[model samples]
Target: MILDTMKRRRSVRRYTGEAIPGDVTEEILKAGLLAPSSRNLKPCYFYVVNDRQLLAQLAAAKKAGGAFLKDASMAIVVCADETKADTWTEDCSIALTYMDLAAAERGIGSCWVQIHLRKDADGNDAEANVRRILHLGDTMRIAGILSLGMTDAYPAPHEESETDRIIRL
Candidate 1:
């Protein structure tokens, strides 16, 4: 059933601009919070943003992507506390993935925008800019951003891939 949900998920860019109910949003955040982390150090912290101005700033945080974030009903800004875990990136990534799959299961659309090690159009660090806008401390590093809303478009599910990458022992 999880694979079926994964199969049906798409990187939905377009959104219907409908607000996800507070309860549903909480459920999605819970999914992220429930993710397993290295050494049981749950390093992930999510900032559920729904402000229009902040969304626009995030949309432009990265030069090549995130344009759809402005229309997203809410964007979950996923960050990690490095001091909490040496493997913060890997830990936070799993949490973000769980949130994405959970959104799809509820018929909500979502997209993940990579921010770490990226730059904005003006050449400043993307992660730093987002931190400034959100007032996050230097100790907190971003894993990614997840835009969530009602679906405006549903891209087709991916076709089965050729079995060339698997290496069985």
Candidate 2:
């Protein structure tokens, strides 16, 4: 079930350095593309990066918390065209979430690294740095990056917990 998959989903940083088969990668990308968008204006874009050099560059896209991407087998840079949708952030986020869950279901580990509104180590805009590395257009606003691969560690599923946040009126 989807909920079971969600429970099993965890942010895995360390990868096994094993290459994910092309079919599995394609399936994960398809899940992102299948994500629903506001008003059906699919503005999100997914950039798959498998090159070791580019992954290392992307790992340094932000100031911290992204170095693990360098060891990932592949990464999907999620972006959206702000000119096409005002809800670009939300749209891209859903796409990333879908992809993450899909990866987990297929036994692939993944981590979401936020990029929008983030700063690089040198204080330059993280999004700009990513754009330079990926050659994306100005209109393409990055939401985040998803580092995917096989992992030696898979944490246990999350336990159920009561929450005060949910209320039915």
Candidate 3:
């Protein structure tokens, strides 16, 4: 069943502009929180944004590949307290991935918008811009944003042949 969900999962950018139900959204967020972290520190934090104006601002957080976020019904900004965990990046990534998968499993479309180590349209640090926009403290290091919504755009699933390299150790 998990594999089936994985096969169904794809990076969805277009949405039908239909809002996800409160319960479904909560389920997705809960899945993210269930992700594992190194030393069980659980440093990752999830910021849910549904405000259209805020979503538009976040859409510009990166120089490219994030414009679609403006149309998403909602977005979950994944970040972590760098001071709390050296593995913040990996932890946050796992959380975001879980959330993405959960959305797909629930018939919702999702897209991962990378922010860490990225630059904004004005060439400023994308992470910094997001932190400022969300009023997050300097210690919060953003991993990415997960844009979610209802959509009819169902891309094909990943084929085994798509794996370019898989060396047996």
Candidate 4:
């Protein structure tokens, strides 16, 4: 059953624009928080963005192929404080994976959005944009984002990985 849920989890790029229920959102976040972290530091933090206007702005800033954020009901910006956990990126990634699987299990669709938090070549602070958009404090750093909504298209089945990719010592 769990494997089925994992297999069904896909990077949904299109959404139906129907807002996810608040209770379901809470459960997804709880699942993310329950993920294991290095030394149990659990330093990941989440910023839930449900504002349509804000989502649009984020979509515009995204350089990736997917435009789902523009029409999705919400986006969860996962962050971490490096001082609390040096392996914050890895921890946040695991949490996001858990959230994705949990969303699929509940019939919700989600896609991961990678973000760069450092200053750009023009000296523009990337973190400043995220902080202003999410009303986050200076201590927090953006790790990644997750666009959430109802699916408008079903994902194709994944192909099997090659056995040669795995090696036993």
The C-alpha stretches of model 3 lying farther than 4 A from their native spots are: none
Clashing pairs in 2: none
Model 4, runs deviating above 4 Å: 117-126
Give Cα-based local distance difference scores for all models. Answer: 0.91, 0.94, 0.94, 0.81
lDDT of 2 by residue, 68-107 (tens): 9999999999999899999999999999999999999988
Q: What residue pairs clash in candidate 3, if any at all?
A: none
lDDT of 1 by residue, 1-169 (tens): 8899998988888888877988889989999999999989888899989999999999999898888999999999999988888898998899999999999988899999999989999899999999999999998999899999898677889887967778888
Number of clashing pairs, model 1? 0
Write down the TM-score of every candidate. Answer: 0.96, 0.96, 0.97, 0.87
Task: State, as a TM-score between 0 and 1, how close model 1 is to the true structure.
Answer: 0.96
Candidate with top TM-score is 3
lDDT of 4 by residue, 1-169 (tens): 8898877778887878877888999999999999999999999998888888998877755445435688888988888887899898899999988998888888888888876554433566656667777787777777678889988686975766777888989
Backbone clash pairs for candidate 4 read none
lDDT for model 4, please: 0.81
What C-alpha lDDT, on a 0 to 100 scale, does residue 86 get in candidate 3?
Answer: 100
Of 3 and 4, the candidate ranking higher by lDDT:
3
